[model samples]
Structure formats: structure tokens, C-alpha cells
Target: MPNARISLPKAKLSAVLGHLAKIPASLSMTTIQTSPDGLWLYQSGHGLDVQLCFPEARTESRVTTSVNTAALAQMVSVAPGEAVEVEVGPSGLKFGTGGYRASLNGLIVDYDEPPIEAEGGVVVPIAELGRAIRCVRHAVGGVNRPHFRGVQLEFSPGNLRAVASDGYRLARYDLGVDGPLNGKAMLPLKPLDAALGILSTQDGAATLQLHGGRLAVIGEAVRLALTPMGQGLPNVENAIPKSYVAEAIVDPRALIQAIRRVSLLSPQDNRRIDLSFSEQRLEVRGAGDYGEGRDEVPLDTYRGEPLALSLNAVYLYDALSCIEGMARIKISDPRSPIAVEALEDARYLGVIAPILNP
Candidate 1:
């Protein structure tokens, strides 16, 4: 029996497991392997594959094994000590530190060597990528809405853009950073969300690589291999109305506060909010079986025709959440969807479809 052993500081090991926590529970097997470069932990789920590497723990020989994910995570998180020890067993893996040791049962699965890097992959700016994903993820569709359940990444040199939609609402974030990727790729929502979280805890840049024709984001210790989701999210640029007859600028924070204040009396089922925009002012009204509530916010730079539009209050709240400073709303007509953008930053854009007021 070739037992593989690895040792690392407690915090490092805990950090690795913490990132793994973001992965969906379905892929419940952990694959441990040793390479000339270092020690690797791999798991796959939600049409995505995640791999973490510890380059400092290079061993002399090659060893690979798969164990139950939950068991491993539990043993590591609850185990005591400042140094972590791992050893492979015939059908399981052992974890120990100082005076504590535990053995976890393994799973009957095979993990062939997966490519961690390609010949020519791009290094993605972690801060930019994380922020971009956050800006657009809210608009991503739910499980039932499979067609729009992923994000489209328009990656090219000197520019990176991410767009997501759920048919009713669309969000886009354009980053003015440079990368070597030149084409577009669609990534499943869960994996992207996990990757975003994992990256938040990490520092430095991550790589955008193609492993067996699948796109992946490889961080210093974390690798998110995204299995592209469905196709044809609504065109973000085309979806934004080219011109609007009415526009209004309002402080997003204040508007959100006003919406929430009036929403206290709104009906739970629909929580409908009626928005009436006109010269230098905007009126927000929320109504339900409890009765109706109205709040007015003075608009800045209001122009063009007066517009009365009905929208779902919850959806409107989400639309405003991403906007920092002031929001400039491009209101075309009562029936047309409104375009919202940040006045201080042009990188983000959002569109919300109106619902029937009555």
C-alpha cells in the first residue's frame, strides 16, 4: 500500500477547505493527488470542477486517492492543532494534528489526471473579475429558468465584460482590464458564484485556461473549471433602449430607503410598486390588501416627458442594489423597460422590465 502523506500549516489547510465549502454538495468526493509540482485536491459538482494546489508540499512519488468530501471537510474543520497532517489509506484517508487523529472512509471513484494548465491561458484580474461577476449575478435566472441561468463572458484584450439575464431583468458589467482571451464563454451560475467567493478570500490574479475544451478559472490555490451552460442570453447592448424620451437621476441609497419604507404596507403576493416620474420629482407608491403607501423622492436632472410605470418592488430593489452614488434611469415609455446605470461609474448597466400596475 503506497500511503500518500501531506503536511501543511493549520490555517492554510483550513483556508483550502473553506473555499471547497462553496462547491455544491452533489459532488461529494474529494480527490487527493501528488505531483512533482505539489499536492492537489480536486472536486467536481454543479457542472463545474474545482482543484486546489499546495506547491510547497511537493512529494517524491506520485499518489492519488478519492475520499468522501463531507468526511474530509468535517475532519479538517473540527480537528484541533496548528499543523495539519494527511495520510492515505487503502480505502480512506487519515487526518491528524498534534494529539488528534481521525480516519474517514473513502469513495469508490477514479480521478484521472486532469490538466491544471494549458499552453496559452490568460491571467485574469481577480478584483475585476469578482466585482464584474457580482454586478451581473443577481440578474441570472433560477433553476427553472435554465435558458438564462448562466453568465456570458465577452473576454478580449484590454476589455472584459460579463452579462446575465433572467428574461425580465438584465445586468451587465464592463471591465476595462486587459487579458489574452479573445472569445466569449458561458459559465454556469453556481460555479461562477463559488469561484467569486473563493477568489474573495484569495490574493493575486487567477488564470483563464482551457482544460479538455472546458473553460476554467485557476487561482493560486483554487481552480474553477466551468462547464459552459445553455446559450443565447439576450443581447445586453441590443436590449438597452438606444434612446429615451424621459430620464431621471436619483440617489440610489435614498431611493432604496424610500422604496423599503413604503413597501412595509405592500401586498406580499406581488408587492407591486407604481413609479410616477415627472419634472424634478419621482413618486413611488406601494399597495396591497393592507392598504396603499406612497412616498415621493425629489429627482435630480429630470427631463423629457412625464412617465408613469409599474414595477415589481422586489425586482426594483435588486436593480438599484448594484448602483453606487446616483442612478440615471432611461425611461422610454410606460410599456418599455427602463435602463439604469450608475452616474459615477459607467462600467455597470441594468434593465428592469415593468409589470402591470393594476
Candidate 2:
């Protein structure tokens, strides 16, 4: 029942508070739970729970009160390099540095401990996990369909896979790890996005705990938990053809630039772009009311017969942007799904369904 005071570097406090500010506004509780060790702020709603703990803060006594996440972040953001002193009293929480001080009233709410279980999870490099998330996040669909709004994570003894799809396109990223893991889970897009933001501020490693119907990501100063989608993800492996009749190898950067140039002429409503590839050149064409545009990019290698396919410009661009060095566009036919693989890294793959009518 005594006032609790804590002190931390302004930049550190600001960084942690920035993550807390990302929590959905729909979540009710906005309280800060403090103990002798550090301060905690948590919020849960829409099947996702996020908590940020400042374990490095120097604390005295104990307190439980809620403060405005935005206000706290703003206060610290302006404080810059100074050390911030946070004192929790009956009236509210006070934030101060060398010359500036401000107070905000705290909200009273019953705080329940967040269900975060980090046991039996694999320790993965933060950079690797972040890369995997970015590779597939764009493919995740909107909230209208709950099942397609998440990324599927498949784990084996030495392999970890992340897959996401929006019915039209799918992304799969495989990572090798030395750990004991054998299961599959779906991680909602919102929490996954939030986890990525938190992970960006951290270095070294992060623990991924998946058990029951929940997935918890434990980072340096942040912890995120979310309920996995109940419905099963589509069998993505089957969607990718075992072999291709034609393969066109092109520089990823050139392909990306060509797509962007042609897409400028594509209509806003029907943004379809045609990719015609033969032995020497890969031509990208787009037509609309605004007229048409075309760009021919030289290919490194082209195998099999000529192939022409129409696809959503955005979808193709998204797939191409994720690839690093060279990209191979493998096609069985114009009607069948087209496969995109990164030449530098075989672990990342993308599939986009062609616009059959176009």
C-alpha cells in the first residue's frame, strides 16, 4: 500500500512503452502492476494477450494502478536521454525526468495473471523468426474469415515451418533448428504482427511456446499470447505442384521493378498483370482504361516451352519482394498455380493462383 518509485533510462522506458501502446484499444484493462522487481502492463482481448515487463527498472515498495499507455509513451518519448523516475501514488502515476514532470490518473481494475507458458518451447534466433513472419504476413487474410487470418506453424525435431495463405496466394518459410518440437499450431495475424514489433527492439533470441490452444512468444521485455484458430489450415503442400513443366529464372530486383512499372497502367479494380516468358526475355504487361504498359526483363535461364500467365499484380509483387537474390518462377500451365522460389534460399517458397479468366 506504499507508493512505489522506479527509475530507468528514458530511451529504454520509451521503447518498452512503445510496444505496450500497440495493444488493441478494445482491450479493457490499462493498469500497471508493480512489485519490487519491476513494472508490468498488460491487456487482453480478441483472442490475444500482450504484456510488457520492465525487469531492469530499479523499483522500491509495491503498487498496482493503471496509466494511459499513450500518455506514458509520449512522456518518455520527449524525455530523450534523461533517466525517468516513475512514482505510483493513490491519486495517480507521476512521470518525471530532470526538469519535466507530469501525472495521470490511474484506472482501477482487477488484474488476472496472463496465461503465458514458455516451457517446452524452442529457442529461435530473433532475426530468423522475424524473417519468417515477414515472409508470410502479407498473405494472411482479413478478419472476416477467422481461419485464414493466421499463419500456420509446423514444427518437427529439427525443422520449423511457417505458412500463411489468403486463398489466392500462399507463403511457406522453413527454418532449421536443434530442439525437440513436434506439432502444428495456427498463430493469428494480429498477435504475430505485435510479436514482430516487440522482437524488432530485442536482440539475440526469443522463445516460442506452443501448447494446447495457446501460443506464447517470450521476448526480452515483452510477452505475447494468443489463441490459435480452431479450424484447420488448408493442406498447403498439396497446393504446390511436385514438378513444373517450365521454369524461368530471373533477377529478383529486375522482376520487381518490371512489375511495378507495368502495374502503373493496371486498373484499380482489375489489377491483373500478364507475365509472358520464353527463352530470352520475361515480359510484364498491364492494360487498363488508362492505357497499357510493358517491360521486358532478361532472364538468367528459361527451361521448357513458353508460358504466359495472368496474375494479380499485387500478389506477384508481394511474392517477388520477399525473395532475396534470384527467383525462379515455375509453372505447370497457365491455369495451374505458379510457384516462386528464392534461389539463394530454398527454404522460402510462394505460390500464387493465376487469374484463369484473364
Candidate 3:
């Protein structure tokens, strides 16, 4: 009967749409639902589902429609700092920004409210929390295993832990929180990646709510709802060794550089890097069909029996990149899992399964 219209600042709308752009095209969830109150976008595929919402003041006209998500995101990205005016009428939806204006065809879909469990969710500081997630996300496994494709978040009194493993390497990060929290959830990678990207652009704190098989991340400019993995994560905590026969404390940056040089000779497939520790130094060696490389760095402290282990060079780099200052490597034997610790921050830990035949 009447045209419905709403206005939004270009920067805010672009940020929200940028998150939606991360969602791949899907037959069921590619459309963005718009209403008098705000905008909505949902994407579901494989075993993961994600929903993003941007709420604003309600307009008098109760118009509702769905538009292509990519189209809207592209339009807003090119017009930064300008105001956007959206009008929905019988013909289609009109998008106007600055001197540019265009019309997009719309579809009508049944809009069901997303189930959000905000009760008793822990509040986490955005800056540190976002950094922690980014550091560990690289270790998450591929889509073949749904359970390993997500990050395990454990919330306890005064602390929040993030853990991820790809069977070969595991990453753990710990952050302090105010008050108490008691819950654990496996968050899918897609939504977690989007949430991290959104949080990077904003300030202040974000709330994490996990209930009823859903995880909701409420931020300043956006809200995200994600489906938790149905299966349980592997018992990684038990795999960490309680005692070590060999320990070496060395500078993380120096070790990282040495590993990078040796990795140049690593095979493309396995990318093996051999680590040898003695009383005086730590030697990193890599050999492949093409060539061989080796580099040794002095260790601040070394004790116990001599130990050597072979592992994926990239995995070691990924684990070390997250740490600062001195890093301690504890080993029971060449066959057992090696524990990597940041001496400065006891809250951070990494484990890499050694290569058996190497």
C-alpha cells in the first residue's frame, strides 16, 4: 500500500554487511531479511548455521522484504562515510548513497525470530578476547570432521579458555574475566571467524551467551547466532604430560626465525622439521628431496637428558607466533607429545604431536 523507508550511516551499515559477505552463497540462507525495525541475514550449510542482526528504530510503515546479501554489501563498501536511504515499495527496494542510487529485486520469506539465550552468559573484553581467538583459529581442522572444525571455549570462575586442535597440533589461550562463569561450548569456525572480524573493528566489550544448542555473540553494532557442534570435543587436557624429562627455555622470536630458515628445505607434503635439544643449544633441521637446512640457537636454560623430535614446521611456527618473550619446551621423549609453554603467561599452552618415522 505504502513505501517503507529507513536511513543508516554508511560506516555502520558497511561493517554489518561486511560480516554478511563472509557467508558463502547458499540456496536457503543467502537472502537478507529487512523489516521496520532492522535488517537480518542468515547462512546455513554443511553442519554450521549463522545469523546476523542489525537493529534500529522502527518506522511507521511495517514493510518487510529480503534482498541479495552480496549486492548490498558491495554497494555499501564503495560509499563510505555517506548516509544510506533504503525504500521498499511494490516494485523493488531502492538503495541510495551520496549521488549514487540503484534498485534491487526483493523476495518475501517467512521471518522467524532467532532463538537467543542471553541469560547468564559471560561478558568478555573485546580486545584480548579477539586476539586469543585469532591466535588459535589456525589450528582448527578441516570440514571433514565437524567436531574438530570448531573452537572449544571453556568458562570458569575468573577465567576464559580457548582451545583448538587439528589432531596434529593444539593451541590454548587463557584470558581473565570478571566474576564467575561455568559453561563450555563448541563454536563453529564460520561464525567464530565472522565474529572475530566484526569485533576487530569495534571497541568496548562483547557478551557471549550459550544455551539451547546455540551461541549468541552480542556486540555494539551487530549480533551473531551460531549453532554449536553436536558431538563432544576430544579429551585434549589429559594428553598433556604432567612431568618432563627434558626442558629448554629459549627466546620465542629467535626460535621462530631459526625454524623459518630450516623450513625452506622441508618437503612440501609433510613439511617436517627436526628439533634437537642438548645442554648448550637447540638445533632445528629440515631435509627434503630438493635440499637440506639447519640452524642452531642458544638456549637460556636446558636440563635433563638430551631429546629430539620431528614435527610439522608450520605447526611449530603457528604455536610460537602466539607467544611472547621466553618459550619453554618440555619433552618426556621423542615419541611422546611435546608441550610448549610461554613462561611469561602460564595461561597459554601448545602441544604438537611428533612425527613417528622422522
lDDT of each: 0.79, 0.80, 0.76
- Candidate 2, residue 246: lDDT: 96
**Which RMSD values do the candidates have, in order?**
2.9, 2.3, 3.3
> Per-residue lDDT for 231-344 in model 3, tens only?
647888877877889999999999999999999999899899999899999999999998999999999999988888899998888888888889998898889888888988
Better of 1 and 3 by TM-score: 1
- TM-score of every candidate: 0.87, 0.91, 0.84
Count: clashes, candidate 3 = 0
Predicted structure 1, TM vs. truth: 0.87
CA displacement after TM-score superposition, residue 344 of candidate 2 (Å): 1.6
Worst 10 residues of 3 by lDDT: 24-33
| Residue 63, model 1: Cα distance from true site in angstroms | 3.6
After superposition, which runs of candidate 1 have C-alpha atoms over 4 Å from their true positions? 1-5, 9-12, 18-27, 81-83, 88-91, 107-112, 119-121, 209-213
Worst 10 residues of 2 by lDDT: 22-31
Residue pairs with backbone overlap in model 2: 31-66
Highest TM-score: give the candidate number: 2
Best by lDDT: 2
Candidate 2, residues 1-358: lDDT per residue as tens digits? 7788887777766776776677676644456778665777676666767776778764766667766778778877887356888787655788776777788787765556755768778888889988997998878887777779889888888888899998889998988875677778887776667667766777777788776677777877667787787875878778887878999889989988998999999978758998898999999999999899999999999999988989999988899888888898899999999999898799899999998772
Against the hidden true structure, what lDDT does model 2 obtain?
A: 0.80
True-vs-predicted CA distance for residue 195, candidate 1, Å: 3.0
